[model samples]
Target: MPLPWDSQHFEISVGQIISPALTNSELENILSYAKEQGYHLIYWATCPDRMIPLPLLQSFSGSLVDRKVTYQRKLSTEFTFGEIKNPSHSFEVIEFPRSQANQQLKTLALIAGAHSRFHDDPCISKEKFAGMYHIWINRSTLHEIADVVFIVKNSANMEDCLGMVTGSVKNGIGKVGLMGVQKKVQGQGIGSLLMKTLHEWLISNGIHTSEVVTQKNNIRACKFYERFGYKLESLQHYYHFWVQL
Candidate 1:
């Protein structure tokens, strides 16, 4: 399952593929084809349960870059919206509108400082990484993939963004697409408040299950989600393969 349209670079989610194994020839052919099709940078994900032989992977000229854990939770019961008071009494959580793309892009740029794994990969520069997220948000707006986006704003000044949360639903399952709190508000409870609100929104929309993924090194994010009842589901190994054009 390669998600080429998700970003400027192509990403093959091997963990999602049920293939027993990718033979040397198959891997070569796939890489060759992707290169022929003008895919300069390619990456893939695999888990312990569906391990790719190290020898087979070593044959490629690419590099292993990141590891992530996927977390999931079932929405069996209704959730009561928890206390999400803004200490300044100036912030409010509101739906993100496509009209505010440019503004949100600025906010996201700041938020992404805490996020360094995928963006910090050798193959991705700061500009390219930001492009990846911009493309994702564009797809979300145009394709309804991530149809739900919420932002915490200062009521006194709507332009003052504190954090953001985004989600998408498909086939009765929901996914937290992205969540970030600005540097200034990281220590505050904004992240937790956003998660609780998103959970409540998912339940109200009849979603039966929801999931999210974060880098293994993101201890704060992992612990935060777990506190909200999201259980560890899978740990995935990530690799990036570069092709010369």
Candidate 2:
């Protein structure tokens, strides 16, 4: 028997249908159907949040699922803001207000990057991915905006000590996702510079607060977000499992 929100808790196998344009009613219908079939946990698409199918929750039938706080961070009503005034690195790229078309290209690129081979399906399929990529690229110019950043390179080459950080803006708040540097890139202030740039962009957009959800064991990431002015808001638990058509 599948858990209440099975599709969200585990990786989807072949034959499992995924949707990018599913409506609230449609998702509820599928979730309801999955519940009746003994499946638990489901994938959800949050569009303004980048349509990334982020496994952000463990949903279930009202009969079986309980919303529990596993990990969370709250935004202040009067959150302090910061801005990036100087740029010392040539690779620091930032985009603004998160254009739908431009973000589509970014998600596609991240899907194809060195780190996305395994989790690509959970995000989007290759065909749909390629299609979205072309659409966004055609509509998005290389205009340097003030709110987005790019750490892109020709390849994923890195020294043993360099670290990297990733983030996203949700409903105007900037949430830092993950950050680590390779040994070579560590201690050179790359991570801080990136952080500064992101915060600057946030302030410029009148976005002062930030939020993100991380697993319980990801202590490093949690601490990093705090250091960047994010306070713990709540804990969240997400379930995973597969569902038969």
Candidate 3:
């Protein structure tokens, strides 16, 4: 499938191989189609249990870029906030207007994607990654991509944002979009607080199940979700195939 948004944003013809299974002949046909369409890159994802042969992908110059992990859990009314170690540094979680906190939210968005797959991909420029996150946060604030955004702010200084989380509900299921804590405030239960706020918001909206995806290489993130009671739902291998002239 052609990714028009990505193609236009990155100034490259980009597409994704959505089919999980591919015969050798079908692979050749897909490559031919990409060339005919002047595609510069094609993305493909597969589960570990049903992956395409390494030699087959090697023939097409497909490079493994990320191991994506999906986590999920059912939201319940029986939820409690984790204890905050520093009562002196009190914080409050609130839903803030985008107009009031766009810049801070953008900063948090950059932090969220700092070590993401896009940042790790050598083919994707750093500038492009930054641009992508900026666009994402902007749209998310507009509710074009996400339903709501919550921020954890210092109680003493409302202007001080320690972390933020974005969530959306669809068909009784909630999904986390972007979440991050300021580097200076990380590991102080701020991330857990943001998640608590997110869970409350999701429950209020009648969403009982929530899901999130992260790079497997991000050990901290994986552990964080696991600690929060989210179980591994699926794991996928992502590849980027750059079409050669």
User: Which number leads on lDDT?
Assistant: 3
Give the worst 10-residue stretch by lDDT in candidate 2. 61-70
lDDT string, candidate 1, 1-245, tens digits: 44545442434221122342566577667767766766655666666465555655555556656677889988766554356655766567887776536556455643643455557566566665676676666555444568777778767877777887778887788898777788766766777777777777888898879999887777787887887788999887676666552
Cα lDDT tens digits, model 2, 123-228, are 3456554554344333333322222433422123321112333555667667654333444344445555556666665666777665555443445545655766
The C-alpha RMSD in Å for every predicted model, in order, reads 4.4, 11.1, 1.9
Give the winner by TM-score: 3
Model 3 alpha-carbon drift over 4 Å, by segment:
50-59, 98-101
Question: By the lDDT metric, which is better: model 1 or model 2?
Answer: 1
TM-score of each: 0.76, 0.42, 0.92
List the lowest-lDDT window of 10 residues for candidate 1.
11-20
- Tens digits of per-residue lDDT, candidate 3, 1-245, equal 99999999989998999986777678768977887778988987876665566766676677788899999999987865668757778889988675533778889999989767778879899999988998898888778888999889888899888899989887778999899899998988888888888898898888899999898988999999999899999998887887753
Ranking by lDDT: 3, 1, 2
Clash counts for the predictions, in order: 0, 43, 0
How big is the RMSD of model 1? Answer: 4.4
Report the lDDT of model 2 for residue 62: 21
